[model samples]
Target: MRANLKLKFEKPLVLPIHYNHIIQAAILKLLSDENYSRFIHDQGFKYEKRHFKMFTFSRLEGNFLIDKGNKTITYFDGASLQISTIEEEFMKYIINNVLLNEGIKLIGNHIQVEKVELKHMDVEEGGGRITTKSPIVVYSTFEIEGRKKTYYYNPKEKEFEEILRKNLIKKYMAYFGKEPKDKYFKITPIENLKESIVIYKGTVIKGWNGIFEVNGSPEILKLAYDVGLGAKNSQGFGCFEFI
Candidate 1:
């Protein structure tokens, strides 16, 4: 099972808000469901400068809400509202205005979100049986420091590729606030290159993804190509290279 908290904020405040606070609030609310609901009904929060009256609730996906005045019902995954918090009747006011707009109050706040997950293992007899099955194949390129290396694997390929992609995305998102997309499908091979060097060869394809060290003296980078050729082409094979 996976758990996550989401929040909705009033527009036009600070240029950038660290959505962490909204996540924290949702976590505390979920942990203290009954008590938190009672608190909101009783000692609600108020703001003077900005009359942002916000009420949050939690709901599962695929829920429905009905508007009594309009005699309309709507299904929604999320919702948000704006109102004044000065008076004790703010909730009533919001209901009279926004909720009356054929909107049903969504459970929990809706905005930037964070996830907290829980997992458990299934235990069963004969669950660990092994079979002789062909492994998945993956072709990956990696870079360390300034050196570059490429690998081809059948089974363990995903392990290395995931690690490398995770590190790269983490570093990139930390600085750029977004993740990088795959570039393999977009690459055009540079064939019959005159200036080229063979880095590694004869590597046994084991898993979908794997990491391999470049043979010979390590200079700037090492790369591996999936040489697609018949067993007859082993000696003096027609080579195809990727740039």
Candidate 2:
């Protein structure tokens, strides 16, 4: 399921530029059903090389209200954000609670949600490949000699392209509990693809949010759209919509 949420604030939401993690944590706080959330969050493969969240979200969109002194952004009150996932119950919970709740706080004590509007999206399914209307973010990390390294996967780099492809195949297996072969889909970053370096909660992340082409089974492609296409999805990355 997918939803577009419009929130109005009494004043511009002043927050640090690297507030993505804060937003992610706020989303998690809404899931009061601890048992179900634990199942959804921790049921995935805990072994090496497979860590991901099932859902995805778009970066914030709106005119900025800037306060250069503290290096904070004051986003306009009517700004919007999009969240998506294949889990139907979770989507319902968001609409019924997150959006419905009055005066919810985000980022810090100052930013309060005065109003919310939720709109459901109708995305068509069944195609060999699909293009995203909104950019999809791709990212991952590697360890080199005991030091952590971040990678921004894009089609421009042939090796990273292959890495992304294999990573996605593993994600498919983890989600559906099926043993699937690699090459199930071909993910190609398209023209106008751009690299983005984001800082979330003091952690630097190298990622890309841009157009991508997916060639594979129609069902799998649809699932990719529903469940997002890459890692850190639940942290507001990799979400896509139909072109």
Candidate 3:
């Protein structure tokens, strides 16, 4: 399930250029249930040593101006953000909390929820084209010179596809509590592939945005659509829409 939130503020919405953490915090703040909030925020669904939040969200969508000097973006009118998740409980909490609250305080700015749209998609036997709502991230960490270093992969790299497939399988296991009958999955860029660099908190992260041909098992494909692709999904990466 997906929830698209249309928001309006009395004044222009201004935020730092790297505002992913801020948006994340705002969403977590909406959870009225304390235990549920801590579970998703601190722990999440566990599989092996990994924790899967099973949700992803898009960047704010609207017309905006960038102040290079200030390193901030200001949206003139309003903005919308789409949140996707496979967990029905989490979806219910977000929708209910947002509707019940009079307004949302995002980064010290008061914004009203103008509208909320719910959507769902069916992935057929054959996969379809998908365009990213947020860039997909794939990376590896290694010990170099007695220090840990992170390397981000380009979409064209073979490792990119391999890691993505493996990641999805793990997510499937985490959610379904069983292995998928079919493990087949592949994603290839079709057009307009672009590299994106994002700063979350203070860490530099790399990702890719593009229209891609996603072919895979229907169940796994649907899971990818629901929870996003690649990595760092909860931190606003790998949200896509079927094209």
Give candidate 2 misplaced runs (Cα > 4 Å): 40-49, 65-69, 108-148, 180-183
- Arranged by TM-score with the best first, the candidates are 3, 2, 1
lDDT of 2: 0.63
Worst 10 residues of 3 by lDDT: 101-110
lDDT of 1 by residue, 70-136 (tens): 6444444432211111122333333333323322222342333222222212222211211111112
RMSD of 3: 1.1
**What Cα-based lDDT does every candidate model obtain?**
0.26, 0.63, 0.90
The TM-score of predicted model 3 comes to 0.96
Q: Which stretch of 10 consecutive residues in model 1 shows the poorest summed lDDT?
A: 216-225
Summarize candidate 2's per-residue lDDT along 1-243 as a digit string, tens digits.
676666676766777866677677767666668886776667634334566566777777788866768878778755677777767777766666664565345866534444455544443343333444334445566899999877665657766556655666666676667755434566666656666666766766666655666566554665667667656677666676655
* Superior by lDDT: candidate 2 or candidate 3: 3
Clashes of each: 18, 0, 0
Query: Per lDDT, what order, best first?
Result: 3, 2, 1
* Per-residue lDDT of candidate 3, residues 113-176 (tens digit): 9999999878886698899999999999999899998999998889999999999999999888
Answer with 1 or 2, whichever has the higher TM-score.
2
Off by more than 4 A, model 3: none
